[model samples]
Target: MTERLMNTLETPCLIIDAQRMDRNIQVMADMARNHQVNLRPHAKTHKIPAIALQQIEAGAVGITVAKIAEAEVMAAHGIRDIFIAYPLVTASKIERAIRLSQRIELIVGVDSLAGAQLLEQIAGRHGHSLQVRLEIDTGLRRTGVLYDQAAALAAEIAGMPHLRLTGIYTFRGSLLAGKPTLDIAAAGKEEGTLMVQLAERLRAQGIAISDVSVGSTPTAAYAAAVEGVTEVRPGTYVFHDRMQARLGACDLEDCAGSVLVTVVSRPSAELAIVDGGSKTFATDIQPGTEPLQLRGFGHILELEDATLARLTEEHGMIELGPQAQAANLRIGDKLRIIPNHICSTVNLHNHVVMQRDQAYKRLPVLARGMLE
Candidate 1:
């Protein structure tokens, strides 16, 4: 589409290039197939059931979500197989999971024995048997049982009456020895090796460990190549972000999502203000981090020399480079910005504009705020 056409559309809206997105989906699907592992792309990134169905049609065996509410939304939209890759610790959430299991094939992630026992109690009351995956901390250190205690915890969870322990999974980025590293290949190899070894040990103890699920977008292919890994859960690859590009996961052109905002002001010669701001783009991945060293909130597609330096609630501050001044950015001029993190940035919008064949269509972000 031309700049004139983009300017005609409303400001501060997400624009997704359908063709680029489909290619990303196909590439990841083929990568999982090539490595002989099931592709279970995490729906937490897109959160739209329609995209989840598209992923399923492209060879994904199932989808992974972060919240029970997200799973509920997807299940309501005809998605049958799902993995709630989060620990449900409360009676209400566990009861909801039990209810969902009756209608779909659900796999819940359990890191603590207490969480599993609660699930067991709720499912038993409902006369249901729930399948579960033990979350092992292969090194992210966010949630999940530590590497040393996984075997013992797995044994305990397996003994529960209503919960069946079928697999082990982890979500770790490029890390070496529990510290972030730039060598994604090595990090992915180690992640796969650790999970596979633990699965073998669990099997030796008479536990039925069928699945060794692992991998993020950066490490999916590398981790999937390991001998015993059965599934991979990669979410961000469907809509590549600036962080993913810097991590070497995808090229800049591979990114399909961008916020279309209009230039609302020019306070100074080098400073240009946009309609979208902190509320518009995600700030989780800060400008300066060790490995990636990302320097901006988002990347401006039209002006390569301009930097999105700052963001308030409703304003994006763009610092123009000396060479970019010739472009003469004026008020009402539209700019396309690829955010640092697409997943969080997506949640902020009520709907997104899908651009296909030079045409635009609005689709509601159905699961945008299903945080519970």
Candidate 2:
């Protein structure tokens, strides 16, 4: 599409290049097949069920979500297989979990024996059983039981009445970004090795661990090839963001999603503001991995060598760097910005504009903000 046509569209809106997204989906799916791992692309990034179906149609076995509300949305949209990769321990969420199980194949993540017991009790009351995967904290230090302590928890959950221990999983998202000097591939290999060792130990303890999953867009491309890993749950590969590019996961051209904003003002020779702000672009900073430094909130595609200084609720401050005299940007000039975090930025928009074959179409973000 031409700049003229893009400018005619509304500002503070999202635009997705369909061709680029299709290519991204195919690339990740093929990577999984080559490594003999099943692909379960996470739906949390692009909560639209249609995109999940597109993934399923492209050799993905299922979809992964982060919350019960997200899983319920997928089930309502006819998605049958789902993995809620979150430690769901609250009582209110358990009732909704039961409802989702009745409608589809649901696999949940749990890090505690108490959480498993709570789910087991509810499943028993509904005359249902829950397929659960124990979350192992490889190194992120966020959620999940420690890797060494997983076997004991696995044994306890496997012996429970209504909850079955189907597998072990981990989300080492923090390790995906590699600095120019760091070895990212080695990190992925280490993660796979840790996961495989834990799975082997559980098998020896008489727990039939079938699935061993690991994920994150930065490491996902190479993680599938790891032995003993049955599945991968990468969410952001569908819409490569600036962070992915900064971390060496994808190139700028491969990023399909961008926040289209019009130049509202050129307050100074070096600074220009846009209609999109923190509310639109989100304030998520790129991962601070050593050797790979990202200096701004986002990158302006049209403004070569420009920096996004900061963003307020209604304004995106763009400070033209030393090269501004070269790229030459002016007021009323529309631009596309690749946000630091695509998932959070996507949730802020009600809909997105898709570009296919030089045409544009609007699609509602059906599952946006389904936080319940």
For residues 7-72, what per-residue lDDT tens digits would candidate 2 score against the true structure?
Answer: 679898999999999999999999999988999999888889989999999999999999899888
Candidate 1 TM-score over all chains jointly = 0.98
Q: 265-336, model 1: which lDDT tens digit per residue?
A: 999999999999989998988888776788789989968789999999999999999877889988998889
- After superposition on all CA atoms, how large is the RMSD of candidate 1? 1.2
Task: State the displacement of the C-alpha of residue 57, model 1, in Å, after optimal TM-score superposition.
Answer: 0.3
What C-alpha lDDT, on a 0 to 100 scale, does residue 289 get in candidate 1?
73
Return the lDDT, model 2, position 318.
Answer: 87
- TM-scores for every candidate against the unseen true structure: 0.98, 0.95
Can you list the residue pairs that collide in candidate 1? none
User: What is the C-alpha local distance difference test score of candidate 1?
Assistant: 0.91
